[model samples]
Target: MGILLLMARERVPRVMRGEIPMASIAVERDAYPLKARLLSNNFDNQFQLPVLFYVGALLAILFQPGWPEVVLAWLFVATRYVHAYIHVTHNRVGKRFMAYAAGLAVLALFWLWLILRLLILAPSI
Candidate 1:
């Protein structure tokens, strides 16, 4: 096992030098391909969903739940920033998905928690 691990480690630089199987979606030498263009569009769409949610949360806080709910909503938006960084900068695979999933989970939980809290705890005020 140790020998195999050492072999893998030795290959790491070679992989970075384009020896590895190309798992990248689409790539071109010195040119951004269609995949990169599509990813950019995807980045833009997902970039705003969480932010809009937080703006809703802020409105609810200043005018209508509690501070905690607002924080929860905003944190998800921040997570999307991390997601984009991973997806674009490093081209990392799993990390972007995890960050994206976390952001979505936070958004869903925020909405549910806010609605339930508003119904069960906070009265019309």
Candidate 2:
């Protein structure tokens, strides 16, 4: 969504400057290929480890989350936001990696908490 917004906002200037054709992106995706590639890569990154985060979130709900789970969830979200910011902006690989790693760590912790809650706290069905 953010990438789409960025692409839409970016089109105005590029179209004026004739960098990208004033046509459908589907027809001229490569008119300004580099930015397109960057946004595309960032969009693809969404499905990677974030898939795990989504699963963990759902499990957290099913397993009955408390303060620790809630805090870890917020941390994970913050890391994703940081990762996206660095990914789309300056795009320094090192910084992007750090943010990604942080998100991964928080996700791991979230899963761990969920597992413990399910095994130790949840009443058997």
Candidate 3:
């Protein structure tokens, strides 16, 4: 959320500088042909895979997930940070995809562990 907020804040100055049109705020489409829309794109990207992260995190907190879960969560966060940096800077699709894939792998592992834990505890519940 902080990252998203920061991106939004940065957009204001860019808009004020006439890099982006005030009317462009109504939609996601970038009107500025010369300016890089890295922040806007990154902000949108946060809503995609990170939705799963939020769900997994809620479940983990509810179930008191183990150290592996915690570690995987941190790994996911780290990869996301890397992804954001790659996305907003060089905008290298290959490198950004790799970072995204790493985060997805971590998230998948975390989900697998969470599901297994739930299955194991289901009988007692």
Pick the TM-score winner: 3
TM-score of 1: 0.57
Weakest lDDT window of 10 consecutive positions for candidate 2: 24-33
| Better lDDT candidate (2, 3) | 3
Ranking by TM-score: 3, 2, 1
lDDT of each: 0.63, 0.80, 0.83
C-alpha RMSD values across all candidates: 11.3, 3.4, 2.7
lDDT of 1 by residue, 27-77 (tens): 632233433443544445564666767566776676455666768866886
lDDT of each residue in 70-125, candidate 3, tens digit only: 99999999999999988877878999999999999999998998898788855774
- Reference-based TM-score of each model: 0.57, 0.77, 0.82
Count steric clashes of candidate 1.
0
Clashes of each: 0, 0, 0
lDDT of 1 at 113: 77
Model 1 weakest lDDT span, ten residues long? 25-34
